[model samples]
Target: MKKLMLFTVIVAISIATKAQQYYDVTKYGAKKDSSTLATKSIAAAIAAASKAGGGTVYFPAGKYLTGPIHLKSNITILIDAGAELHFSDNFDHYLPMVESRYEGVDVFSFSPLFYAYKAENIAIKGRGLINGHGKKWWDYALTFYKNQTARNKYQLLFDSANKNIVLPDDATQMQRGFLRPPFIQPLYCKNVLIEGITITNSPFWTVNPEFCENVTVTGVTINNPKSPNTDGINPSSCRYVHISDCHISVGDDCITIKSGKDVPGRTKAFPAENITITNCTMLSGHGGVVIGSEMSGDVKKVTISNCVFDGTDRGIRIKTTRGRGGVVEDIRVDNIVMKNIRDQAIVLDMEYSKTKPEPVSERTPKFRNIRFSNITAYTKKAMYINGLDEMPVSEISLHDVVFEAETGIVIRNVQDIELRHVRVNTKTGPAVSAEKSSRILIDALSTVKPLMDAPLIRLTDVKEALLTNHWLFDGSHKFADIKGAATSNILLHNNILKGATVTTAADVPTGTVQL
Candidate 1:
C-alpha cells in the first residue's frame, strides 16, 4: 500500500511539473509585432519544448507572424485568447518542398502552415486565431486557370509526377510546383487534437489530416470565404475520427471525408472508417458534409448527426467517378437541417468526372448501405442519385425527410431503395421519380403542394416497386405515370389517391401495375 501511494504521488508530481513547463516563443526571440517574421523563433521554442521531453509551447496575447510551424510528438501549442498566429504569404518561405500529397496524389509540395510528419499525441488548443493569409496563393492559382499555357504546364508536371518522374527540388509555384499546401496537415499521425481555435484564410483545405488515426477536432471555427479550395476539416485516409461543435463557413466543402485517390490510393489500400461528425453548423460552402471524389481507397462506417447547413451549394454529397475504384458504404446521417441550399439538398453521384462507359471492374466505384433520417431542407433541388449504368448504387434508405424545393427527388440507376415518411413540396416535376431502378419501397410519401400537370410519382424501367400508404392532396392531377416495357410488378396498396388518375404509357405491358 505504501509503495502504490508513493508511485501515485510521483506520477501526479511528474504531471504537474510537465504542466508548469512552458516554452514561451518570446524567450526564443519571437517578436510580438506582426510585421516581423518570427518563424525561426517559433521553431526554436518548439524545438526547446521537444528537447525538454514534451511541453506546451505557449503564445501570449499578441500577434506573431511566422512561416510553417513544424510540430513534434507529445507537443501542445497553446495560443492565448488574444494571440494570433499569422502565417506568412511569402511563397519562398515555404521553401525547397517537402514530402506531401496534393489532391490525393503523392507529390513533394510546399509544407503546410502547421504540419507534423509521423507524429503522435500532438495537440493545438486554446481560444485564439490562425490566419493563413492565402490571398496571394489564391491569386497565383487563378492565373493558371485563366492562362491555358500555365494550366497545361501544371498538368504536364502533375502527369509526369504520376509516372514516377521526380520534380525539381527548387521548382517554384509558377513552374513545376503548382499545388497549394493545406493549412494544418498532420501526415501519418496518431492521437491528434485540434480545439477551440478560429482558423481563417487558409491556402487550401484547412485542418486536413492525412493518414492519421484517433483524431478529434471540436469547438473549432473556420471561416475562409471566397478562398479557393479552402475546405474546412478534411480527414483523408484516416480512421477513428470525431468532429463536433464546429462552425464552418468556407469556400469549399465544410467537412469532407476521403481515402486517397486512383491507382496510388488503391495501392495504399487504407480505408477511412469509423468517423463521426455531429453538432456542426455550416455556412457558405460548397457542401455541408461531403465524402470523396478522392475515395479510391474506400470509405465506410461514417455517421453525421445533428448538423445544420445554411447557404451552402449542397447539403450532403457523396461523389466519385468511374476511374475511382472503391466502395462507400455504411453511412448514416440523421437530424440534419439545411436552408438556402443552392444545389440539390442531397446527392450521390458516381459520375463526378465523366468518362466513357466501361465494364464493371475494380475501376467502377460502388455506393451502398447509406441511410438518412429526420432531414429537413429548403433548396433548389431536393435529392438526386445518379449511379453508373453498369454498376448502380444500391441499398439506400431514407426516413422522415421533408424537402421544399423547386424540383423533387430523382433516382436513376439504383436498386433496393426504401423511403418512409418522405415529403416533398416542389414547384414542378413529380414528387418522386425513378428510372433504371428496382426493388423500391416508398411508404407514406406525400407532397404538400403537388404540380397539377405532373404525376406524383413516375417510374421508368423499374421493377418490383411498392408504393404504399401515400396521402395525395386535393390538387393532385395524376397519381402515377408508369412507362417502359421493362417495368413490371408495381404494386400500389392502401393509398388515398384523392381522385387522381393513374396513367401508363403505351410501351408498358398489361398487368404491370396492380391497384
Candidate 2:
C-alpha cells in the first residue's frame, strides 16, 4: 500500500510538470493585431519550447499573421479556441526550396506552410483555425497558365519528371512559377497527431503526410473552396495511418492515398500499407475516398468503412494508368452511404491517362482482389470499371450493395467478378452490363423499379458466367439480354421475374441457356 501511494504521487507530479511546460506566444511579444507580422515572435516561442526539452507552444486568443513555421522534434503547437494563424501571401516566406513532392514526383520546391522533415513525436492540436491566404497564389498560377512561355516551361518540367530527369535548380524552375505547396506537410516523421483544427483556403492539398508512420488525423475540419488541387487529407507513402471523425469538404478528393509515381515511385519501393479510414463525412469533393492516380509504388491492405459522402463528384474512386507499374490489391470498402454524386458512385479505371500499352514491362499497372460490400448510393451513374486489355482486373467482389442512379454498372476487361445479393436501380439503363469480361457470377440481383428498354442484366463478349436468382421488381423490360459472338457457356436459371423474358442476338451461341 505504501509503494502504491508513492507511485501515485510520482505520477501526479509528472502530470503537473507537463502541464506547467507551456510557453505562451504573448510572452514572446506576439500581439493580437492581425496587421502586424508575428512570424518571428511565433518562431521564438517554438524555439523556447524546444530549448526547454520539448514543450507546448500555446497561442492565446489572437489573429496571428505568420509565414512558414518549421516544426521540430518533440514539440506541440496548441492554438487556443479563439486563436487564428493566418498565413502570409508573400511567396518569399517559403523560399530556399526543400525536398518535397509536387503531384507524385519528387522535386526541390517551395516548402509547405507548416513543414516538418524527419521529426519525431510532434502534434498540432487545439480548436483553432489555420487559414492559408491563398488568393494571391491562385491568381499567380492562373497567370502562369495563361502565359505561353510559362505553360510550355511547366509542361517541360512534367515531361522531364516522367523520364526521371531532374531540373536545374529552384531559381530556374521558379521562372515558370507553377509549383504550389501544401498547407501542412510532415515528411518522414513518426508519431504525428493533428487534431481539432479547422483548416481553410489552402493553396494546394490541405494536410498531406508523406513517408510518415503512426499518423492519426482525427476531428479535423477541412473547408477549402472548389479550387484546384485542394485535397483534404492525403496520405502518401505512409504506414499505420488512422483517419477518423474528419469532416472534409474540399475541391479535390477528400482523402486520397498515394505512393509516388511511375519510375521514381518504383525506385523508392515504399508501398502505402495498413491504412484505415472510418466514421468520416465528406462533402463537395472530387472523390469521397480515393486511391491514386499516383500509386506507382503500390497500395495494399486499405480499409474504408462507415463513411458518408454527400454531394461529391465520385464516391469511391481508384485510378491508375500505364507507366504506373504498380499493383493495387487487397482493398476492402464496406458500409458506405453516398448521395448527390455527380459521376459514378464507384469507379476503378486502370486507363487513367489513356497511355497505350507498351511491351509488358515495369510500367504496366495491375489491380486485383478488391472487394466492396454493404454500400448504398444514389447518384447519376452507378459504377464504372474499365480495365486494360493487356492486364485485366481480377477477383473483384461485391455483396449486399445497393445503387440507384441514372445509369447502371458497366464492366470491361475484368475477370473473376462476383456480385452476390446486389441491388442496382437505374432509371434509364441496364442494371448490370459486362463486355470483354469472363468468369462473372451474378446472384440475387434486383432493381429498384422496372425499366422498359433496359434489361435487368446484359452480357456481351463474356464467357463462363452464371446469372440466377434475380428479383426484378417491376419487370418492365426483358430479364436478360445476351449478345455478341464470343459470349458462351452462360447459364440463366431459376429467376423470380413473373413476366420477364430473355432476348438473344443471332450471334449468341446455343450453349448459352435460358430456363
Candidate 3:
C-alpha cells in the first residue's frame, strides 16, 4: 500500500506539471490578422509542444490563416473561444501530396486541413471555429468539370487509383481531380477527442476519422451549406466511436458510417463496428444518419437513439450495392423523431447503384437483424426496403412506429419481418405493401382515413403472413388485397373493419384465412 500510494502521488505530480506547459502560437511568430499566412508559426508551436513531451498548443482569440496543420501524438490544439483557424484557399499551399483516402479510395493528394497519421491521444477541443475557405475549392471544381483537359487528367488519376498504382511524379494527374481535401482527418489514430468546436464551409467531409479507434465526438456543431460533398461526421472503418449532443446541418448526409468501397475496400476488409449516436439534431441533409454507398468492409453493432431529424432528405438510410462484399447487421435504433423528411423515413436499399441482378458471390451485400422502435416520422414515404432478388434482406423488426406520409411502406425481397403497434396515415397507396417476401407478422396496426380504392394492406408474391388486431376507420378502402401466383397462407383475424372488403386473386380462393 505504501508503494502504491507513492506511485499515485508521482503520477499526479507529473500530470500537474504537464498541465502548466502551454505553447502559444503568437509566441511562435503567428500573426493575429487573417491576411498574413501563419502556417509555419502554427506548425512551430505544435512541434514545440510535441518536443516538450506533449502539451497544449494554444491559439488565442484571432483569425489565424494557415495551410495544412500536421498533428502529433499526445498533443492538443486548443482554439480558444472567438478564435478561428481559417484555411488558405490556395491549392498550392497544400502541396507536397500526402498519403490519404479520398471517397473511400486511397490516394496521394493534398493534405486535409488538420491531418494526423498513426497519432495517439490527440484532441481538438474548445469553443472555436475551423473554417475551410470552400468557395475557391468549389469554384475550381466547377471549372475542372467543364474543361476536357481537366477531365482527361482526372481520368488518369482515377485509372491509377483503381490499378493501385501511385504516380507521385505526374503533376498533371496529381492536380487533376478537384477532389478537395477533408476538413479534419486523423487516419489510423487512437484515443481521439473532438469536442465543442464549430466547423463551417468544409471543402469535403468535415470530421472524418478513418481507420481509427476509441474516438469520441461530442458537443460539436457543423454548418456547411452550398458546399458539395460536405458530410458532417463520417467515421469510416473505425471502431468504438461515440457521437452525442451534436447539431449538424450540411449539404450531404449529416452523419454517415462507412468502411470502404469496392475492390480496395474488400481487400483491406476492415469492419466498422461498435458505434453509438445519441441526442443529436440533424437538419437539411441527404439523410440524418446513413450507412454506405461505400460499405464494402461490413458495418455492425450500431445503435442510435434520442435523435431528431428535421428537414432532411431521409431520416435513416442504409444503402449498399453489388461489388461490395459486406454484411450490415445488428443495428438498433429507437426514440427518433423526424419532421419534413423529403424521402422515406426509414429505408434499407441493397441496390443503391447496381441496376441489374448479378450472381451472388463474395461481392453480394447482405443486411440482416436490424430493429427500429419508438419512431415517429412525418415524411413523403413511411418506409422502403428494397433488397436484391438473389439474396433477400432478412430478420427486420419495427415496434411502436407512427408515420404520417403521402405514401406508405413498400417492401420487396425481404423475409422474417415483424411490425407491432405500428400506425401509418397515408394520403395515397396501401398502408403496407409487400412483394416477394415471406414470414411477416403485423400485429396491432392501424391506419388513419385510408383511400377509397387503395387497400389498407396489399400483398403480392408473399407467403406465411399474419395480420391481426388492426382498425380501419370510416371512408376506408378494402381491408386486404392479396394477389400474385406465389401468394399463399395469409391469416387476417380479429380486425375491426368498417366498409371494407377482402379481395384476392382467382387462385387465392378466400385468401383471408382464419386460424
Candidate 4:
C-alpha cells in the first residue's frame, strides 16, 4: 500500500509540475460565476497567456460562456474537472467569418467555436465537459427539411427552407452554424494535441483539424448522437495524424479522414496520408472508421487496428462517388471486432449517391488498392464490394477473414484479388460471388451449416482467374454462383466439397487447365 500510494503521488506531482506555467482565468479578471462579460475576459486571458510565452490556460469549474476562444501557439486550454464551458447561442458573438471546411467543401463559413488557425503546438485537454448547446440549430434543420413540395420546387431534397448555410458573408442569411459551431477546429496548424477531453453535444462537428499536420488526439470521448453533420473528428487534408483510445458515438462517422473533393480538391492536389487509428470504440453511427467521399487529391497509407464497433452501421467502410474524382489506395484494416452490424461488415461502395437533385457534373465513386485481413465479424448482413462496371476496383486482398453474416459476400468490378484462409458460415446463403476482374485467386476456404448458404465461387467477365484448395463441408454445394461467361484463363485445383455442386465448361479440366 505504501508503494502504491507513493506511485500515485509521484504521478500526480509530475502532472502538476509539468503544468507549472498556468494562467488561471480568475486571476486575469475573469468571473468564476456567470457574470458580465466573462466570455471576453476568459478569451483575453487565453490570448494574453500566449503573448507572454505559451502555457496552460485553466478554465475552473463553472459555466464559461464564450463566443469564440482563439488559442495561440504553444498554448493548452485545460478545463479543470467539473468544468462546463457553455457557448452562447446568440449568433452575434462570432463575427468575421474564417476559412473552414463545411460538409465537404472549403468555405469561409461561420467561425468555429473553439478555433486555432495557423498556430502550432496547441491543445484542448483535461477531464472536463465541453458542451456546444447546439440543439436549436439541429431541430431547426430537421423541421425545415420536412417540406417536400418546397424541396422539389427549389431543387432541394432536405432542408429546403435553409437554401444554404454560409459564414454570412452578406450578414443577412443568419449564422445558424455560428449559434453553436464546431466545438474545436485547428486549421492549418501543426503539432496539435486534443487529449483527455469529454466533448459532447456539439452543434457541428466535434474536432476538425483541417490542413494541419502532426496531430495527436488521444484518450478523448465524444458523445453527440442527435446532431446533424456532427462527425467526431474529421482530419481533412491533414497529414501524420494519430487518433487512439477514444469513444466516439455521433450521428455521422466516428473519424472521417479526407483529402479534398471534386474540382477544388483535385486542382489543389493535397491528399490526406499517414493516418493511424487504434484502440477505439464506436456506438451507432454511419461508419466506424471511414475514408473519403471527399478525397479528390488522393487518400493513401491508412492503417486501422484494435477497434470495436457495436451496433454501428459498418466496421470499416470506404465510400466515394464517380464524379468526386478521388483515388483511395494502399489501405489496411485488421484486428477488428464487430457485432450487430446493420449493413455489410466490410463495405466498399463507389456509387453512394445522395437523392438530392443537383446539376450532374461528375459524382461517381472510384476505389482501388484496398485490403482487409484478420477480422472477425458477427454481422446481420454479409460483406459487400461494389465497384464500377466502367472503372473497377484494383489490387484488392482479403486474408484470414472470418464471417458469420446473414447475407453472402459480393465482389464486383475488381482486379488482382487474392483471398486466402477465408471462412464464411451463414445460415442460408452463397459463400463467394465475384465479377469483372483479372488475375484473381482464392485458396483455403472453409464453410459451415451449408444449405441456405451454399458455396458459389465463380468469375464473370474476369481475366486470368485462379482458384485452389477450396474446401466445403456440412453437406454444402460447391460452384454456387459463377455466371460470368466472358471471363478467361480459368484455373482450378485441389478443392474438396460435399453435397456442393460444380458447374463449368465441359472442355475445362478439374486442375491446372488454362483457358
> TM-score: which candidate is best?
1
| Model 3 whole-model lDDT (C-alpha atoms) | 0.89
For each candidate, what TM-score against the reference?
0.93, 0.92, 0.93, 0.85
Model 4: lowest-lDDT 10 consecutive positions: 166-175
- Tens digit of lDDT per residue, candidate 2, span 56-84? 98988889898888889998989889999
TM-score of candidate 4 relative to the true fold:
0.85
Which stretches of candidate 4 lie above 4 Å from their native place?
1-19, 35-37, 145-180, 354-366, 505-515
Which has the higher lDDT value, candidate number 2 or candidate number 3?
Answer: 3
Give the clashing residue pairs of candidate 2, or none.
Answer: none
lDDT of 2 at 282: 99
* Stretches of model 2 off by over 4 angstroms after superposition: 1-20, 148-177
In candidate 2, what residue range of length 10 has the lowest lDDT sum?
166-175
Off by over 4 Å in 3: 1-15, 150-176, 507-515
| 37: Cα error in model 3, Å | 1.0
For the record, the alpha-carbon RMSD of candidate 2 to the native fold, in angstroms, is 3.8
Ranking by lDDT: 1, 3, 2, 4
Error of 3 at 367 (Å): 0.6
User: Residue 114 in model 2: shift from native, Å?
Assistant: 0.6
TM-score of 2: 0.92
Q: Model 3, 17-42: lDDT tens per residue? A: 87777898999998888878999998
